[model samples]
Target: MTGAVATAPAARTGRAPAPRPVSPTARQMRRAGWWFLAVPLALFVVFMLLPMGMAAVISLTDYAIIGDTAWVGWQNYARIWDDAFFWTALRNTARYTLMYVPLGLVVALGTALLLNRSYRAVRLFRTLFYIPVVSSTVATATIWYWLLNPQKGLLNVALGWFGIDGPRWLYDSQWAMTAIVLMSVWAGFGTNMIIFLGGLQGVPGDLYEAARLDGANVWQQFRYVTLPSLTRTTFLVSTLLIIGAFQVFDQAYVLTKGGPGNSTVTMVYYIYNKGFGSLEMGYASALSFVLFLIILVFSLINARLNRPGDGGRVRRRRVPAAVPSAVAAR
Candidate 1:
């Protein structure tokens, strides 16, 4: 009888179990989620992906606004190789990125460190620092235009009090880019400061206590504990700074208009001139692709360099013998 029962069950096992039915509410919620995502997805395809596809196609042809559109294959891209202005703009942008990213990082991180405490005054200071970020870029540039005036400007006037002559800021080719860098950093660092402040607040308090117990000084704690903990935040800030520096336009446009021998002409400004000013849409599109590639390369490098599990580039030093092993492990 047992053998017959087992045989009967084995015969029934060949048939699969019926699937469970999903509830009406579960199905409705899933449908609603897709419905919510549809608008953004449609917008993304219409605006971003469509324009990018159009730009890629446009880059392959000589599509001057009023002229006959003719396919030029890769000639437009080849022209970029010999374009002296393109190279100059790229070099100026690189210089700006080098100056702007490091300085901005330092200023933002410094301000964030200073304001990471809990106090009524700290809240006021954070708001004050963030004001420049929300201010209109054109308005900020206008203000800097007067402040950087070579002869009668506030910056030079203050220098005059010290008996040191301030260099011609926007007017001098040598200093035009520098002045723009200064303005860009001052106007933009507040956003990065806020980002860093968030990161600082997220760091585990236990790590600081561990470091303190291990006899770590403030600088040592910052260098080892804080620096390691904030690597991802630093990476994000630096990447944003690099992208922004390459595309800088309003400051250069409002302050210098890419003047003083094209010293402050960024890649985006040059592309704007080609596309709209000169109406070489094909060439401009090609330049834009090149700029995109450059940004992508730099961003990839930054990501690899700051990837988790690598403790960043902070120099390791011997901790005092009295320091605990826990601090050293960090």
Candidate 2:
């Protein structure tokens, strides 16, 4: 019995096999993945995150490019309250946004609608329209600058044929901002038009057919069917236009230099002036944060306003159910 018990115990205590070592190929793949991750992580830390942190810290100090730095603790932000020029820049930017956004929407939507249909020339037209978008900002600005020349410009010359006197565009303080708005719309609408075109394609043909079967006119079909479908696209285009309008700098800088009594000075141009022209890096950083906050607020507002819903409440008529003859008889 003791011998049997010993043998049973030995059988139960049999050893398990050892684990296999990792292959060199698997180890090499793991090393390669680490290497792949290392560069981008290092770049994000060095360029993006580090710069943002430094800018935030700098915003609290008085760090003129050539002078001793002093911690001022929100004095720069306080100064923005009293800065009349800053307020003017803000107003100018607001005005540009107001003018640019609506006009851009109309033009982009119109062009998109016109080109949405199939035709032999459609591709050519799209390419031509998108050419301006691909052109550099400097190049477009240069072209517009020549076209807006007060006396010798093509615009006034064209107006002359119509027997209408044209006002000075870029040179006139009253019209400089207006001219800039026109140029901006023309140069930028192509991109949004493409977006609208894409949106138009996604709209179901069955909806339009149903609307027509219900005796809906073209305008009604568009109002009820097309508009609801393009809600997200419109939101996207409007948000982009708002952001671009606020950050307008290249056109104003290249065409007018915020000249003719600063009529065209935008918030971004103001920030650039403060940071580089005046060498007030700390103040510039503070102003930059203020603009950032404004953009963030507007973006949030846009998102809230355009949040998904049923588009509109379209009520369908409900029919009464028919009773069975046997039940009725009973």
Report the error of model 2 at residue 17, Å.
26
Return the TM-score for each candidate structure: 0.91, 0.81
**Which lDDT tens digits does candidate 1 get at residues 146-250?**
999987899999999999999999989999999998999999988999999999988889988988887788987887778888998999998898889888888
Please provide, for model 2 over 239-296, each residue's C-alpha lDDT reduced to its tens digit, 9 standing for 90 to 100. 9998998899999998899988999999999999999999999999999999989988
RMSD of candidates 1 onward, in order: 3.6, 9.1
Q: Total clashing residue pairs per candidate? A: 0, 0
After TM-score superposition, the amount by which residue 4's alpha carbon in candidate 1 deviates from its true location, in angstroms, is 20
- lDDT against the true structure, each candidate: 0.90, 0.87
* Candidate 2 RMSD to the correct structure: 9.1
Off by over 4 Å in 2: 1-47, 309-330
lDDT of 1 at 53: 100
Model 1 is weakest, by summed lDDT over 10 consecutive residues, at 308-317
